[model samples]
Target: MTRRQAITATATLGLALLLLAMGAAARPLLVDEHPLSRPVLNPTEIGFAQDMLAHHSQALIMTARLDQTADPTVVALADRIEATQREEIGELKGWLRMAGASTVNNAPMQWMHPNNSVTDHHHHAATPSETADGGPAMPGMATQTELDALSAARGTDAARSFLHMMTRHHYGGIQMAQAANNLLTDGIVKQTARDMMTNQTQEAALMEIMLNSLTTAR
Candidate 1:
């Protein structure tokens, strides 16, 4: 080829390469890589975190009364539950915050079962178990009267009451956790829910055994 032709070819190739480089540099970055990325959390994930936070809070409250009981085994079990649940509460709250959700939602269980009418401080046509004050009644949760009864009892009575309430509470928690596992795809959220179900199911069985022993003694 001639010298001029060679120079022209080299210049043309350089121009093309520069254009390609500019195009590559000008391309937009993926929006998902932003600090608040999508896909947004679904209702179920948000609902589970909100509900479980309250649920775990109640468990902690029940366990707090265990120190009043005489049975060392019961006290030990309560301690374990309180510690495990407390840590899990932090995790749940953190997950909610990271997802840009509020920890203090008024309609607690509405996410689990959606209803358009349910609003803060009111749940029109709510399920029978739900209270106007506290939202829906999760499975196996103790009523105020029951909590009072547990708090008032002492020695073996306190021990038995604690066992009974905890057994029920764990079962309820497992149901919610299982639902979270089913609905959520987030790795940490799903794993945490699965762990709760496994651990609480075992705890519920142990509580039943303790309750039985107490009953037989009575």
Candidate 2:
């Protein structure tokens, strides 16, 4: 089997017991050459940076619920997620503040393939999605159905829903982050994107593990 297959199998079989003992403490290795580094921030970067902060802020609000009522295991995970995302929100805001940009731009953009990357070269800070084919797509965010379900859950139920929806949430998030990585030149934004990729990827893996535990227990 391929290395990925091997890792998947290992993750499926043994990762659970290890997680309870090890918890979610994996820190990403910072590679020297940033794949997302750029020099000049673009509209795409501004939109991505601000939108992601808003998105993650919602996650923080959701995860805080877990901290209040979930099992200890889930509460542990929620705490980690909340801490990391809070720090990221601060970092993204700092970038906007430094750029003298308002995070409140109403420009609607979607996350698109690299072919349609939007750079904030104009420094409009208006957001890329506001422009359409003029920029990337940033829609498909979680809806009220998902949020209500999250609010209604308790114990492992809450844990499972949080992880499942959050996996999808982080999937979109990674797309936005990748766009920012490609579209911006600001060192801090680039660093923040890299950190998001590293940390969220690891958290997603752990969430999947916890999710499987929920299934098996059922």
Candidate 3:
């Protein structure tokens, strides 16, 4: 081949190699390092965090009243509930914040039944619980009257009331956690929800056993 032909062919090959290298380097920047990239979470995850926070808050309130009971078993159970739930609440809040989600939501449980904008009468599905003044209600929450009653009870009565209320509360919590397990894409959030469901289910069973004991004694 002529020197000129050899030089031109070498130049063409070098330019092609450089172009390929540039594209290779730019590929990741275009796909992974885009400035608009943000963590994606669905509505179900957001609702779970928001609803569970409210649910755990009520659990804390109930557990705080454990001092009114003379039962050591009851008090110990309450202490465990308070401590575990507080930590879980923190985790939920952290996950929500990291995902750029707000714990504050205008409509509660919408993700549980996304299709049903109105309140429906299904066991698994939930509609938003609204008050006369339009305040949202947490599922399985005790009324103020019930709270006052629980506060006034002593001995076995307090123990029994707490067990009854808490068991119901945990059922609601398990439902929410199960929904989260099904919905959330994030591994941390999904695993957290699974742990919650398992823990709360066992706790609820224990509470029922204790409640039955109290009943049998009377």
lDDT of each: 0.78, 0.68, 0.79
What pairs collide in candidate 1?
none
Model 2 per-residue lDDT at 70: 71
Q: Write the per-residue lDDT of candidate 1 for residues 1-218, one digit (tens) a residue.
A: 99999999999999999999987776645343347556445667778888899889888988876645369999988989999999999988888888889886676666655644455424323322354344345666667767778878899989988998888788888878887887776777788889999999999999999999989999
RMSD of 1: 4.2
**Candidate 1: worst 10 consecutive residues by lDDT?**
120-129
Tens-digit lDDT string for candidate 2 (23-106)? 534423434344765434566667677788777876786786552677677778778888888888887788778667887546
Any runs in candidate 1 off by more than 4 Å, and if so which? 1-25, 29-36, 39-41, 114-136
Model 1 earns a TM-score of 0.77
Clashes of each: 0, 16, 0
TM-score of each: 0.77, 0.65, 0.77
* lDDT measured at residue 67 in model 2 versus the true structure, 0 to 100: 29
TM for candidate 3 is 0.77
Give the C-alpha lDDT of model 1. Answer: 0.78
TM-score head-to-head 1 vs 2, winner: 1
Better of 2 and 3 by lDDT: 3
- Which candidate tops TM-score? 3
